[model samples]
Target: MKRVVITSVGAVTPVGLDAESMWQNVKQGKHGFAPISSFDTSRLKVKNAAEIRNWDPVAMGLNKKEARRMDRYTQFAMAAAKQLIDSAGDLSGIDPYRAGVIVGSGIGGFQSTVTEHAKFLEKGPDRVSVFLIPMMICNMAAGQIAIEYKFRGDNFAPVTACATSAHAIGEAFRKIKDGYLDLCITGGSEGSINEFAVAGFQNMGALTESQDCDRLCIPFDKERSGFVMSEGAGLLLLEEYEHAKARGAQILGEIVGYGATDDAHHITGPDPEGDGAAHAMLHAIREAGIEPGEVGYINAHGTSTPLNEQCETAAIKRAFGEHAYKLAVSSTKSVTGHMLGAAGGVEAIITMKALEEGVLPPTVGYKVPDELCDLDYVTEGARKTEIKYALSNSLGFGGHNASLLLKKFEG
Candidate 1:
């Protein structure tokens, strides 16, 4: 099989606006979740969120008019794409036909969609802005990035709920490996923390009932309850290994394996036995031709939701046996909150950072770890260690599960 590598990464997360800022906050065990300020939350049951606070996309070099027409989610993606391209240098040197984009969103511009719909209802059919459809469509995230960067290759925007970004990245990996594209920009974005989204999560009991500052978003903790609504975007520049080497591109990590599965049991709940989740992890391990023991750490899909934490624990144990107890597991979500579809991509960056920096982030707010999740979670604090390989799992609503394996770049 052809080799694929991640050349550059960028992020717009609750912790910060770029990958370096997010990683620094992650290392310090910072919590981005706070009472919602983007919108009035006086009456909402879940009032706290990990918002991309006071973000001005103009810092990413986009003009006001252009950025204004874009919905917040798309704006975030565009900003992140700018960071990615800036870090990767001028892609103009490469063939435009050989470059492509694959980005996704679980819920595309919920705030924009709901706002425009309200306008139409409050005034007349013509009250909705002309940019409504363009700004609200999920594909626009990928489309806008491709247009800005002059990438004329394949562009896709998968919508698999939370699994959206994971599938997008995984599929892009296959494309590069199969020789369909030489360079691909891929990742996920989300900006759905509006009234409707918060209400929906609250009605479904997905957000924590408690407003306690320290108790919120405690993933894999004995008192863990539900996820905190969050917003952000993560983008990765991936290239064929030979193409990267020929160009002297910096390699962050190699994509060794990817696996996706469905619970086939419920739309919102994971299989209690972790059947589907385990299959995803095991499939990744088997595809990489590596033993479970080879994995040194896991960027867990530990969403801080009760069922997901428990089921993921079962899945890890089933997939790795004794190795499960030895591996360092940490949830970046514990600090960044849950970026939904973008979780996979952001966590992928975290895994690569861990490998490169030799520093493992601790799962903050893990005062009392759940008995079911008995593992060396690196919870005491950030620890310096050599991580040969790492796994990042992303499970979304609708029974979607995805796992990706990233190895420390040796070339």
Candidate 2:
């Protein structure tokens, strides 16, 4: 089997428009949360969200005509893909058949659906957009990315709720590792910060109604509420180890292991005992041929929800034993406000940066820790430490769990 490495990465987060800027802001403990500005939230119980302010697609280099046809989610995906391709340099020598795209979106074109349905209700069925179906489907992000780059190889999107992007990256890694593809664009994007989405989550008691930015999205804290809905995109350019070396590509990190599992216990909650999540982490560590103690950091799927943090902590302890306390663990969601489908992709990039820079990002807004969550959450600030292997976990609503093991590039 061939090895796979991440060559380039791009991010469109609430805090920064690019991966480096986002990393720097995260290292500085800057959060992107604020009162929602995309729409008037007078009717919403949830007041604030981590929104990408001043988002202008045309300014990002997309033509107006192209932007008009896409949902906001697809626009973010295209922008991230452009950044990834630009950073990856010339890939002209790669066969189109050996290149692929696997970008997923948990809630696709939500704004479009709400807008078009309202139009249909008021203006008649004839007023509905012909492009509505193409724009709102969850798979359009992957399709549009493949179309943009002319990739002819395996192209599809995995829709595993919050774990969508992690599954996408894991599947892409396997394709390259098994020699099915030489290169792939993989990650997830989300642009569902609309009133309908917010209302849905809030009504379900899955979103924080906090008006205070500092108190919002406090993962692993005793006062932690539900997640704050956010929007963004994160994409990674992955290539076979030999293929990347042949092209003289700058290898950012190596994906050594991936483990995916399901709880089969709840539709919207993780297993109370975190059995599925624990097994997923163990599987990933075993696949990497590394002991539990070797993992120095974990970008946990700590969603700031009471049940999730407790369960994730249990899973970490179950998987790592005493090592769980020794290793550092933090949640970037406290800064990004839960990007939903994009969370995994964004957190994966953060984990890679932490491994490469030897700086573990802090779980900002963390205070009043819960006794259930006893792990060493780097809460005070970003901590600098040297480490080899790390894990990024993404647990989705359908009990879907994915763990990715990344190693700093030694060669």
Candidate 3:
């Protein structure tokens, strides 16, 4: 089997526009939550979201015509992809057929769907734009990225709700490890912060009602309410170890193991026993050929929701035994809000950064902890620590669970 290594990473996040900038912001324990400005929220109970402020597609290098035809999520993906490609110097050596793209979005073109549907109701079906269908599908982000970069090998988008991007990255690792491809671009994007999307989530009781930015999205805190909707993109470039080493590529980290499982328990709630999530973690650790104690940090799927935090804590204890207490665990969602499908990709980047830099990001806003979540939550601030292995977990709405184990690149 071939080894898979991350060559470059890029992000379009609420806290920052690029991966390095986001890492710096996270290290300082900064958050991006604010009142919803994308639309009037007077009619809704949820009033705030982590929006990517001052976003200008043209400034990100997309022409007006291209931006108009594509959905906002796709635009975010393209921008992140551009950043990844730019940082990955001299990729022209790899064959196009040996390259691939896998980008996923939980809710793709939601604003487009709402806008065109409103137009159809107001005027007529003919009033709708011609690009509606192509723009609204969840797979267009991957399709557009493939077209942009001309990658021809095994390209597809995974749609596992919040676990979407983790699955994307994990599958990409498999493609390279199994010798199906030499290089791949993988991640997730989301742009569904409009009023309609907010309304749907709020009505479902999945959005935080806290009007205060400081109080909102407090993962693992007893005062936690629900997740705040956020929009952004996170992408990474992965290449075979030999392929990257031959080109003198700057390796960021190595993806050593991945595990995916389904709860089969509920539509929107995790299994109360956390059996599925525990197995996923164990599978990942087992695949990495390392003991649970070797994993020093975990970027939890701590969505700030009561059920998610409690269940994930239980899962961790079940998987790691006594070592669960020895490891540092945090949820960057407390900083970035819930990016939904993009959460996995973004958190993966953060984990890789933490492993490379010897820092563990804190779960900001964590106060009044619950007894159920008794592990070290890293609430005070970012901790300086050297860790060999880091695991990132992403659990989606539909009982989807994915864990990616990354090792600090020693070579």
Better of 1 and 2 by TM-score: 2
Q: In model 1, what are the clashing residue pairs, if there are any? A: none
Q: All candidates' lDDT scores? A: 0.88, 0.93, 0.93
Lowest summed lDDT window (length 10), candidate 3: 195-204
Give the Cα error of residue 264 in candidate 1, in Å. 0.4
Q: How far is candidate 3 from the true structure (C-alpha RMSD, Å)?
A: 0.7
Candidate 2 — which residues are off by over 4 angstroms? none
**lDDT per residue as tens, model 1, 48-156:** 9889877888877787999989999999898889899899965657989889999999988787899999999999888899999999999999999989988888898
TM-score of 1: 0.98
lDDT per residue as tens, model 3, 122-161: 9998999999999999999999989988999888999999
Off by over 4 Å in 1: none
How many backbone clashes does every candidate have? 0, 0, 0
Per-candidate TM equals: 0.98, 0.99, 0.99
